[model samples]
Target: MIDITIEKNLKVYQGKQILKINRQFLSGSITKIYGPSGAGKTTFLKIIAGLISPEKGKIVIDDITWLNTDAGINLSPQKRMPGFVFQDYALFPNMTVLQHLEYATGDKDWINRLLLLGKLDTLTDHKPTHLSGGQQQRLAILRALAIKPKLILMDEPFSALDPEMKAELIGGLKVVFKGLGATVLIVSHNPIELEGLVDGELYIAG
Candidate 1:
């Protein structure tokens, strides 16, 4: 289980805003997060991933403390090691699809399986510049899965995919997530996009 209570100051066009959240995420659950445009959904994920530090917060996962502002303890991103799929896809300009997964894990078998799951097996040699927008997004998802992380944070992961592709990928990801027993939190703008995939929902108001 993951427990979090965080407070951060956000900069908005009008003025400063505080983003505060106190929540718990059950183990192995898939959660869909949605809210207004500047509601700090992505910031919430980033804070949990250790990419952004909150002004004050405490985060504990499975009895392990990841962050405790009162104690002046904050784990580094590498130590936290959650699989993060950035909104931009964040693919390497020079690395091919195969290389991306290889960088994350040495197991060729697992890499091949991820490629197949993402439907990028045939495009293994293609670089980010060569892949289409949807393919790039798939590569980002596959790269995150390559590490077999316990916690996966995805920011607008399915925005570029077509409906058919999104549905198929979601089905495959369900099996993979279950097999790994990974807790996933996805930030999405579209409410209905993840209808059947998410086991829980979180709404953050700006």
Candidate 2:
């Protein structure tokens, strides 16, 4: 299980936003996190990934302390390498599609499987600039999976794909997640996209 209870003061355009999260995520589960803008949804994910720090709180995963403010125990991002797919689809402008996966792992067979899953086998040599927006987004997803992480966090991952492609990819990802037994947390505004795909939901009020 993953337990998180944190508080942070976010400097937004309007004013200081107090972001507080208290949640428990089960292992090998799918959770959909939704909320209004400026609710610190992205910040919450960052905190979980150890990319950001909260003024006070603790994060414990399977009895292992990932973060404990009082104890001064905070694991680095590299130590808690959860697969993260950013909302903007942060892809390398220089690396080719194949290179992205190669950078994550040297498992050529796994890379080939991911390429087939993302339908990027033909575009393996293409750079981010040469690919379309949907393709770039797919590459980001593929790269995240190349590491075969136990915890996957995605922000608006399907926003760029068409309905058909999104549906297909979700189906394929279900199998992958099941195979890896990875718990997934996806932040999306549109719940319709994840309808029957998610087993749990976490709503944040902005």
lDDT of 1: 0.95
Worst 10 residues of 1 by lDDT: 190-199
Candidate 1 TM-score, C-alpha based: 0.98
Alpha carbon deviation, residue 130, candidate 1 (Å): 0.4
Q: Give one digit per residue, the lDDT tens place, for model 1 in 1-206.
A: 99999999999998999999999999999999999999999999999999999999999988999999999999999999999999988899989999999989999999989999999999999989999999999999999999999999999999999999999999999999999999999999997989888999899997
Candidate number achieving the greatest lDDT relative to the actual structure = 1
Off by over 4 Å in 2: none
Over 1-206, each residue of candidate 2 has an lDDT whose tens digit, in order, gives 98999999999896788888899999999999999998999999889899999999899988889999999999999999989998888898889999999999999999999999999999989999999889999999999999999889898899899999999999999999999999999999886999889999999885
Per-candidate TM-scores read: 0.98, 0.98
Clash count (model 2, backbone only): 0
Candidate 1: residue 24 Cα off by (Å): 0.5
